[model samples]
Target: MTTLKALKGQHHVSAITANAMKNYEFYTKILGLRLVKKTVNQDDTSVYHLFFADERGNPGTDLTFFEIPRAGHTYYGSNSVSTTSLRVPKDASLEYWKNRFNEFEIEHDEISIVSGRATLAFRDFEGQRLALVSDENNVGVAGGKPWDKSPVALEHAIVGLGPVTLTVQNISALSSVLKDIMGYREKGKYEAEGHEVVVFETGEGGTGAEVHVVARPDLPAERPGRGSVHHVAFRVENQEELIKWANYLKELRIPNSGFVERYYFKSLYFREPNGILFELATDGPGFEGDEPFETLGENLSLPLYFEAQRKEIEAKLKPLDTREGGKN
Candidate 1:
């Protein structure tokens, strides 16, 4: 089989959290992604499952959430297991995020470049490690970074993710998964923050092409708690493609890390023998199907299970802050 060259796109990366409302404010109000979908976890009701993404709620722009059951406080272990980094248009990083954070009074740390690009590092409301990188080759956004109060002109803000970091005890197993199953090509290796990080390039790396995997040797394993990465999703072409990878994992005898229908995509999950979790995600029938861009995340979008309770659903949902954030 020809080794996979690059990821098809990013569907959604999920995280477990304690407060669904808090997640809403941070991702939609603070980070500036649109709350494309809001509903309860079908697997378990009473727990909120949310999604945030770019203008049209495209597959690659998606970042998802799962409110865990009676979650406990979290701790950030040694090194970051995974960091969701978005690719921004060159020159938009400093002005855009700097002023945006300052205006909102959101605290963040600035890094010109940890490895190969100008990056601004910060934590989200959920304590997720995130970065905004001004990629030299960024193609910019179609709607011109539609979020509000950005220091840089909307024309040059982040279009979508540039890359990401995934931790593993050893690179051998995870690396093989990346090369054989995920279609990622090793870009090169670089030293940063006192650790050697390997970078992989996926797609054009801006829209559907932006995926990155790193072999984090020094990062300690993070216990799944209130605040931790629940999962990282790598996009595939469709359900058919998702099945092939799912069977491949089964053939490898990788345990229950297999495909599950996620409404929009199909997914398979497994941990590298070293204990790092990995997933193969698919993309289709994305967020726009439920809501328009101008009014996203402002209302409740439920699955068929909750269709009869739109009123109950809308009433139960916490009110969306009507305040137009200057820096969101």
Candidate 2:
């Protein structure tokens, strides 16, 4: 078995949202993540593509979305990303978030211990599920660079994305991809919402290193739309490593999008046996590829191919007001 030693942690989790402004406010104003990229989806030039992350838009911190109002509500079931978990400091930070969520009238669950870590689960404005998992070992926050201008105090600001839950009908097949191809190890298991959940961990077993799988044999397959996760990306070192991963996926006979250039990073996409989309993305040519780090997401950016239609694209996109507390 060829081991994916160059594979790092998660790159980003991409999902769909109906309202662009609502999604923007929730992630930026409410959650305090930096809007690292304001661009249009490469495939769909009209809809907005937004990326949020820690201060620098690091690989593991990214959570991206595509605004598609006409896509309608997501069908909940197997073969989908059920929830995304963000990392925060343990104890005090978790308390701070709970209070903050309360102050903002955000609905969230009481802190529950999952795999020995304190977790507070919540939903976004569009009903996209999310969770904040405390780094019980207190190591993940030490290196995190939070957005200084965020309303949330720097200390309590979310660090980055951690484990993301994938609901699958065929857990055994997906588990093989995580273990044999993606360099993840089975760490622990627990029951959640009546489903048996198995935990997997990658590099060093801390924040940004976990992926949870929930087996949902009784549920039907999901329909992708608003609130539906489009794909989950795993990080590779660079283009070289990305190509290696693409080759590996080919050898495994997994159908994949080979070596796609996404401007900011190169990507190779594939689906596991259960039809959940996954991507292996490189870390470099980061979010700052087009704009300087200081001005990231400050204005609209178009890919080279779409640059010709910038005027038309901008005209079609509904204005997004990211100003403090601005509502749509």
Model 2 lDDT per residue over 218-297, tens place: 99999888878999998888888787787887888888999998988899998999999898888888877688877788
Error of 2 at 212 (Å): 0.7
| Residue 33, candidate 1: C-alpha displacement in angstroms | 1.6
Candidate 2 global lDDT:
0.83
Write down the worst ten-residue block by lDDT for model 2: 319-328
Clashes per prediction?
Answer: 12, 0
Query: Per-residue lDDT tens digits of candidate 1, residues 36-133?
Result: 67766766655678776666556667777887657876665532346777656665556677778888777688757755577887777657777787
